[model samples]
Target: MNEQLQSITGVILAGGQSRRMGRNKATLTVQQQSLLEIMLNKLRSVFQHVVLSGSQAAAYHTGLPVIDDFFPGCGPLAGIHAALKLCAGRGVFVIGCDMPLVPPELIRYICNCSNFDLVVPRVGDYLEPLCAFYHRSCLPFIEQALNQGRYKITSFFPRVRARYLTAEEISRFAPPDRAFFNINTPADWDRFCALYPDLKA
Candidate 1:
């Protein structure tokens, strides 16, 4: 079945501790809306089933269901694991909650790539795994890696039919750097504000 037969679930990775930012990055705001709200709006624009990959469902009242990590303390890979199970028999399109600048167009492009078991973007030498797609076919690999305590998100990439979007390809929607920009610290937040000075709140 293709992405259509089962539909891809849009997952927002919101379980981060945000140690560097020194606050809940998901609650940080732009134009009066929280980063979490911004990411949710982006996902809702592209997918029918949108959810948050976080255990603190009580903290967020976005109206969308939040799926807790099945492999607690396993990092982002745990979120992906829970998402893969929730997709029924398809794949998932996921993104980090701190990435408020991510465009829905880029997300759509990733979701369109149904031919690969893993679809991610590479900007320069770094892979944007949070803003990628993972198929159910990747379940076993993810499971094995997590079970073995190899929680790195890319640990199982080599074992799957992986596809990485080039920086040039990503430029069609937004600058590769801008599209995947995530706020991890106060300095990064300042940079984002400087990058978009007009953005209030």
Candidate 2:
């Protein structure tokens, strides 16, 4: 696992068309730092290489490579496929741009596990596929799904060697509910502000 950690690359999925936020979510500031910058800092602390998977290259500002989705508008699956292909390794840690409240320890823990083709966390019944671990070997399956017009990130799970981190395990990494808070709409942002008023100040 340690050996794999040395080879694991971090991939930030930031190519979303944030219609709900009425702006680019990647550029949205949280506590004076853009979510992209926060995620990059967290990723850089543990991974050997971290790449931003999105359309805006300059917005990343991390100096790491920026990978544009090969199939635009196909959603997170396309971002996963592109990261796996562009990464200089087999396993990659993936996260979303809106997930500003991501626990850094959770990411480090994910990087510590590499035997499985994927390591995804479940928040309640919903699988947080956007923030998960994926191997390059799954690219073909993803490509196949994309070709079939299936854009769901979970569509290829049945064919892969996946390990699902239950809500119980997720709580271990992110206790008291600060692990998977991803902002989708303006309401979510307002809620975050209410929850973490210091983050806004």
Candidate that would win on TM-score: 1
- Candidate 1 wrongly placed segments (more than 4 Å): 1-6, 199-201
What digit string (tens of lDDT, one per residue) describes model 1 on residues 98-124?
888788888888878867999999987
In Å, residue 107's CA in model 1 sits off its true spot by 0.7
With a 3 Å backbone cut-off (N, CA, C), the pairs that clash in candidate 1 are none
> What's the residue-level lDDT of 81 in candidate 1?
93
TM-scores, all models, native as reference: 0.94, 0.92
Candidate 2 per-residue lDDT over residues 31-148, each given as its tens digit: 6888778777878877878888878654656677899888888888988888888888767899987776677777777666667888888767688887789987788999999999
- Stretch of 10 with least lDDT, candidate 2: 169-178
RMSD of each: 2.4, 2.2
